[model samples]
Every structure is written in C-alpha cells, then in structure tokens.
Target: MSTILVTGGTGNLGALVVTRLRDQGHEVRVLSRHSPEFPVDLRDGSGLDAAMAGAEVVVHCASSPRGGDEQAAGHLIRAARRSGTVAHVVYISIVGVDVVPLGYYETKLRVERLLEGSGLGFTILRTTQFHDLVAEVVDRVAKLPVALLPKGVRVQPIAVEEVADRLAELAVAAPAGRVADMGGPEIRTLEEWGRSYLAARGRGRRVVPVPLAGKAYGGFRRGGNLTPSRAVGRTTFAEFLERRG
Candidate 1:
C-alpha cells in the first residue's frame, strides 16, 4: 500500500477521497489547515514539507475560486519536488477550464500547466461541475421570489462521490497525464435544472432566464462547459436531488 497525502482532506470531495483510499488499506495523511494532525496550509507552503515527508502520492483537491490558486499550486509543486518521495500528484480540474474564459477557469488551467512542467509524475482529471454546486446555485436563487438563471447556459453536473472515486483510483495507479474529461450523464439548461430543483423541494417559483453579457457567459451559452461525448457519470441531477432529500 502507498502512503498518500491529500490536501483539502476535509472538503466535500477530498474527504470522500481520503475515506476511499483508507478503505483500500493505503496509509492516508490529510494535509490541511483544518486538519488536527497535519495542520499545513497550502497557500504559503507552511508545514507542507513535514506533511509530505514520506508520501508516495499527493491528491491535490484544495482550490479556491476566490483566488490564490496559482500561488498555492506553485508552492505545492516546489514542496513535492523537495520531498523527493511523492511519485504521483493527482489534480482535480474543471472540464472547460481551457475554453471557459472565466477567471476561476483560467486559474485552474494555469495550475494544470504548472503541474505539467513541474518534472513530477502527475495526472490531471478535468470534470464537469458537481451536483452539490448546482444544488447550491439553485438554493441561492430559490431564496428570491423569482429564480434567475443564466440564459442559454447548459450544465453537466456529476456526483462528488463519483469524482472522489475516480481520484482515488488515479492515486493508486500510474500517472497517465491528462485523462478523458468526465461529465454528467445528462446535459440540461439552467431553467430545466432550476425547475427540477424547485419541483423536488415542493416549491412553486417562477424561473426566469436572464441574458448575461461578456465572453464568459457567451462561452457558457455556446456549450464550452459541456462534454456531451464523455457523459460517463451515472447519477443525474434529479437523482442527486432525490438522494439528498
């Protein structure tokens, strides 16, 4: 069994990945500021070397859309090289990061490039949005009397558990560089998703499609965020809502 370290082990996806790795008899170390045992922050590389000392694999699941992702990724790459023990670094990225034009997507793409040139064996898996994120958006919009959704935007949201499972698999296997993009089983518009969410919650709200400007929104409208051919995820949005209820 490999000694694996997971950054962001307390997060929605990282937590599950940690559990799966442990269940397979791998020695798992969780590196995060919130972790009691390994309270290392990835932003500044504080205490990172200690956490990564003997790790054979590092699953990078810590990322913030708010910013600082580039700095964190750089720190991680440097630390992994210094450790000289980590053989595989698995990264979770968004599916359309290269085409999406959003600031967060750009940051993710930059991080991917950093890992590619870090001289370390790495695997990058780009996946569609998670069901939890979509649910959160719907919940936020439902708070208002009229639910506002982006016009002509479509989403293919996969389950966080499925993504975690995939990450765990990659952590134990050989580094395959960039893998096929993983997408949800179905692609639906924002209005359809919002209506499904409202119906599942037994709420009656008018779903309004608001036209959003800018290249980012246009990218979304053009389906830059979707991978119709790679719809490998099994759980649909409706099923995700049912399971949560």
Candidate 2:
C-alpha cells in the first residue's frame, strides 16, 4: 500500500479522505499547522518536507476559503514539486472558480493554475458546492420569517463524502490532469433548496427571491458557480439530510 499524505486533515473533507485511505489499508498521515501529530503548514514551507518524506502521493486539500492576494498556494505547489517524493498531487478545487469572479474563487483558480504549472504529475478535481454549505445557509435563513435568497441562483450541491471518495481515488492513481467536473444528481435554485430544508425540519419559512446585486451574488445568480450538465455525484440533498438525522 502507498503512503498517502493529506493536507488539512483536520477539516471536514480532509478528515474523511484520511479515514478512507486508512480503511483501505494504506498508510495515511495528516498534516496540520499546529497539531503535534504530523505538524505541517502549506502556507509556509515549515515541516513540509518531513510530511512528504517517503510519501507516495500528496493530496492537497489545504486551502483558504477566504481569498487573499498572496503567493502562499504557489509556494506550497513549488515545495511539492521540489520534494520529488510525491508521485501524484490531487488538488481539490471548486467548479467554475475560473468563471466566477469572486475573491475566494479567484484564489482557488490561482492554486489550480499553480498545480498545472508545477509540472508535477497532478489530478485536479473541481467539484460543486457541498450540500452542507446549503444546509448552513438554510439554517441561517430560517431565522428570518422570509428568507432572502438570490433569484435565479442555481446549484448542484453534492455530498462531502462523495467528494472525499473522488479525491481518494485520484490520490491512489496516476495523475489524470483535470477530471470531469462532478456535481449532484439534481439542479436546484437557492430558494427551492431553502424551502425544502425548512419543510424537512418541520420549520415554517417562506423564501423571498431577490435579484442579487453584488459581484459574488451576481456570479451565483448567473449560474457561474454551478454545474448543470455534469451530474455524476450519487448523493442527493434529501439523502444528505436523512443521513444527518
């Protein structure tokens, strides 16, 4: 079995990736910034070499959701390239990061480009927004008597478990460059999803559709951050909610 190194192992997706790899009988190591176990941070080159030592593959799940104008991601990719021990670098990127001109998405897009330019064998898996994200928004919107949702915003929300599975598969194999974008089985609007979630929770909340004004909201409303044609992910929103219960 190969030694798999997962960055951001404490996170929702990274933790799942490490668990799956370990379940498959592979040696799995987690890299974190402050954790005593396998302490490593991609933001800087600190402890990176030690984390990558003797590892067959490095799954780069580490990232800042808050966008920044810096070269931190590039530094990490360069370090991975220099390590020479990593056979495959599986990068988890978001769908339409390139099309959506949002700040966080811009960072993700930059990181994806850095991976491609690193010249290291890499597999980039661009996935849809997590169903958990939708659930979080639904919960917050439920506080209001009428939820203010972006009109015409479409999303194909996939489960984080499915995303972890795909990332693990990519880490175990040879780099495929860029894979087909994966999303949920169904297309939905923000309002529709929020309503369904409220109904599922036996909560009463009306969805008030409003035209998105800002750049981020505009991008979402224009469907720049969603995948419609690609419906490869098996988990649905209803399945996710049921599993949560």
Best by TM-score: 1
Query: lDDT tens string, model 1, 1-245?
Result: 99999988889999999999999999999987877878898778898899989888999999998999999999988999999998889999998899989999999999999999999999999999999998899899889999999988999999999999999999999999999999999999988998988888999999999999999999999999999999999998888988998
In TM-score terms, candidate 2 sits at 0.93
Q: Could you tell me which 10 consecutive residues in candidate 1 have the lowest summed lDDT?
A: 34-43
In candidate 1, position 178 carries an lDDT of 100
Tens-digit lDDT string for candidate 2 (48-134): 777777887888787776643236556666667677777788888899898888888888887788878887888999999999999
lDDT of 2 at 195: 86
Quote the positional error of residue 110 for candidate 1 in Å.
0.2
* Candidate 1 regions with alpha-carbon error over 4 angstroms: none
After superposition of all CA atoms, the RMSD between model 2 and the true structure is 1.7
Task: For candidate 1, list the clashing residue pairs, or say none.
Answer: none
TM-score of each: 0.99, 0.93
